[model samples]
Target chain A: MTQHTQPSAKALVPFVSVDNMMRLIHHVGLEQMLRDLAGYVEDDFKRWELFDKTPRVASHSDVGVIELMPTSDGESYGFKYVNGHPKNTSEGLQTVTAFGLLADVYTGYPVLLTEMTILTALRTAATSAMVAKYLAPKGATTMAMIGNGAQSEFQSLAMKAICGITSVRLYDKDPAATAKCAANLAGTGLNVVICTSPEQAIEGAQILTTCTADKQSATILSDNMVGAGVHINAIGGDCPGKTELAAGILSRSDVFVEFPPQTRVEGEIQQMPEDFPVTELWQVITGAKTGRSSAEQITLFDSVGFAIEDFSALRYVRDHIKGSDFFFELDMLADPDDPRDLFGMVQRAAR
Target chain B: MTQHTQPSAKALVPFVSVDNMMRLIHHVGLEQMLRDLAGYVEDDFKRWELFDKTPRVASHSDVGVIELMPTSDGESYGFKYVNGHPKNTSEGLQTVTAFGLLADVYTGYPVLLTEMTILTALRTAATSAMVAKYLAPKGATTMAMIGNGAQSEFQSLAMKAICGITSVRLYDKDPAATAKCAANLAGTGLNVVICTSPEQAIEGAQILTTCTADKQSATILSDNMVGAGVHINAIGGDCPGKTELAAGILSRSDVFVEFPPQTRVEGEIQQMPEDFPVTELWQVITGAKTGRSSAEQITLFDSVGFAIEDFSALRYVRDHIKGSDFFFELDMLADPDDPRDLFGMVQRAAR
Candidate 1:
């Protein structure tokens, strides 16, 4: 009898845990990592037509929703499993948690699996700042960060790293959240101001980022508050029945979104009629359409998040972890000595 | 600044790797575990109406396909990531590999993560045998196992444990596969016979199971090869453009399927017309429909596998790991003392 003691190397997959992800972020430097991730996001956007895009598969319940966002670029496939429960905060848990996987399209074998809660934060911010690079007003140095939550600091730093923003004004309905955001950015080289009101946060800022955590249609930015030549990065208004910006603001701004069919149901544009005109961000990134045509024109990136951004983030992580000790091999696949003898392998394990 | 070291308990999810799963199967005893898993699959089938079912989301490449199958039972959500690459065998890789996750729908937090490659085999065999228990002829004891591949032994043992089978006759196109299967089943209590031809293997057998792993359509069983009163468990004719049984066989048999919408595209019934009449297996389990009506009736279970079976398998693992040292806690989620201070959490980790 031949003894099969250990699984083959093919059974192992690289897994990046949350602790390792934080370590990798620090090792790469947060700002530089954000900048690098933004480059990947921009590159993917340029080739978005090649991706197999679909709206996220979501299972909605009364308290929250669990979603699977999957996309393939023909060579590799990636998906992120994420859950959003606004009520989790009350129970001392994160409102969102995620993990992602990347696999080889040829062999259908997973190449990487990583915790994406922190990575999602990084990618979302990078995607926002990347879009702003093509749509925000020239020489924009100030951002009005409304709803200072878990995503606020990342958004602020991403803007500073990618868009050269030097100042961030933060505001949230909860004063403690605003204070936490201010403290987190204390020595990040950016001038951080804690604002008491949303109106005050937007004062004299050329970029307005609204990322409230509410699951309802609360107007964090009214039409009157958003001035011309400012780029509105509206990410908080994701999912149905959740809109942070006013309908009039969307009516006046030249709205750009990450996939129109999805944005029509989940983004801020959901409040608009079905036939409302909006440009796909991929077109703008590819130079097929004009962006920021005039200094006084309002550009709204109605960002509801997309699968391609996660695919690019997965690609970046898979590439970065090649020569780094940032990931560990997980015995996640069953590789029998002979592919047809899975039972014999299990039976031999008892020996 | 107060120092926050280590992630909170809520941030950790229990992960059962392949080694631990093998250990778990051996600890519980293989046949007993099969019976137990069959119970869970049967229980889930009885309450099938309570489940949220959707066709698997597949990403097809020229060489293979990757899929995400997700389902929820209102309180708990489950998903399995699986891939199939038939060409992988020549490269010494398994044709299929899988992993699954179970999460709490209320809080939207994952509670269990496990390697499902082995579990999927167990669940697939258990589901087949459980359905045969209801549909196979009374006092059935012999099964002709066609396509002696990775799933053959598991199918044989599951039928022995759950359906009172005492003998298995195995045949495969590759004689080496048949030799390996016979060698694996040598010490088992059941009478195992190795046959050269599929016809010789099914002589007087009360059950027939075909599980060939080819991506293209191949007829492993013809209409004249089958007789009345035998249960046919056709499992490998899954996915589009792949099938195993002749259309004449399906035309003469009363077919039972897991999910009609899915089976129409992936099951052996894919060769059948779209409006072809077939009873759902869940209805038979719930006593809402008939199983085997007479000794001369041929019952064919068109098993393409479904998310609910994977969900039930996940539920079984979660329950079985409660007080056992079969899993390790993985720090997969980012937990901050303040849910809104994720950036602060990462920043503090640097210190």
Candidate 2:
């Protein structure tokens, strides 16, 4: 029975879904996994030259945007099909959902198909915390999270686990969202406070995180609300017309982005001129550029997402589930005895 | 019993490999599917305005090329991952292999994942024959095929069935490839003749197709070889550095393409001037532009493969596999009752 369902020549692809990834998080412990994932993301950025990168291909519609993010490291290739539709929550669906493939470059056969809905959140938060570790001051302990929506708790947990953040402040347009975030953060050895406004949320925080999801340009943080020596993790301003921080915030800080060309179009830097002088995060990780200038300087990580993060996360899932029950085999590649006989496989199937 | 596999909201992504796609073709019969898929592709082209049509995104490497072809009609979206590696045959692989997905636009959930390697061959041929129905001379009979590789048989059969072609003149650099084509076309009832050169193949032919898989500027057809009123289906010149015909031929022909912006980059027209006039194929299919204006004026359908053809083929597969054993479900979207409870699913997986 097992012989019939499997291919003869190629390796079987493994299917990893949202539920399985969640189970993986639970099995490995989210705190440990988040820290581990942050390490992987940082390591990938350190050697960015291995990747052949391009700005994501995005198709914008009236309601939302769908994008294809493709990258290859000459040895392996990966791409994700992701969509962002803020109105989906109103229909009891997620604002974002995704799945991706990792393929071997030699044979061009897909080896893994992963559900990225859960992994994207984990990787996004891990990316934010990883950047904070580089740019934030030593012994940074406080983080204020605005937009206490679906991504809020993830932001809090990732910062706490990866960047040693022990205190968090939360605020949102919906008080219930804030309350839920606070409840989720309880018993994590972190002090959580619910604030009323964005100003109050960012008052004395060392790291200010904004993970809001909306279609319009809403300023989650204003210039006056920010202070020196803070690392702003703006995760929501990723679409062509959507942004989180005000233009003044970008001007006052050293803006670091995932990919410069894409950041100029979709990141908060969209509000700035083309020559606004933004540094790519990989350059900082690779020691090609400095991340933080001084103790009194403000830093902004205008991440519109990139392909390297997914590659790291995919490798992480593959490594973690190597001996686990979460693994599944898929017929993803053609296994031919004589590869020239691909047509014969069809003839056999018909017979 | 059903929940033994951990019913947390993880996605299950089903995949059909290249071998399985060929099996689907053999199981469904290529003749019927060619007829059926042509109808679907033509129908989609008729409603061309509804699709969000942008040019394909490509990543070119030293060895070969990888492409992402995406399109959405608001309600549904589709894209294909295809690679064109001309030298892959030396490594016992086909020159082209493809896979694609169909997803709901609102949810970003992939409803189907299919092996598109074999389907691409069928769709490309059917699409060529589809455009030729309207653009070629009514009841065109003889066709000259200049390249005979893996894609040769499909093009011959599709044009024979769809355009009433009664004869095919075959030519290739390797006689073995030509013999392979003649063997595949043995029982198709069309008069198949092996020609020594491109000059002999195009003599007195109504439709001349050039699909040689070369990676450089190759002059497979010159201006003198093509006669008056001949409909040229230029299918092989689809990359930045690849071309099939001499510029002198395009200098005299009325060229049409799937999308002008894309065709100029990847079609035979890439060799022509920036302002070279070309009409979108939809205009001819919708009867908005007069097709084959007088059998005396040379017509060139600069056929760079388009996303809409893959979209149509995917739709046909999705429809035909509804009640068949070929169907498999993929966890492409995170299905959570509460979209914000992705963390909870991870937490429960620990149990």
Question: Which candidate tops DockQ?
Answer: 1
In candidate 1, stretches whose alpha carbon ends up further than 4 angstroms from where it belongs are A1-4, B1-5
Scored on chain A only, each candidate's TM-score is: 0.98, 0.95
Give a tens-digit lDDT track for model 2, residues B167-278.
Answer: 9999998887788778768877999999999999988788999988889999999778877888999998988889999999999999989988888988888888899998
Chain B only: TM-score of model 1: 0.98
Query: What tens-digit string does per-residue lDDT give for candidate 1 at B154-249?
Result: 999999999999999999999999999899888889899999999999998999999999999999998899998899999899999999999999
* Residue B204 miss distance in model 1 (angstroms): 0.3
Q: Candidate 2: which stretches are off by over 4 Å?
A: A1-6, A194-200, A318-326, A333-345, B1-27
For candidate 2, the docking band is acceptable
Worst 10 residues of 1 chain A by lDDT: A1-10
For model 1, residues A1-351, the per-residue Cα lDDT tens digits are 223367778899999988888888888899999999999999999999999999999999998999999999999999999999998999999999999999999989899999999999999999999999999999999999998899999999999999999999989999988888888899899999888999999999999999987889998888788778899999898899999998999988999999999999999988988999999999999999998899899999999889999999999999998888888888899999899888987887887
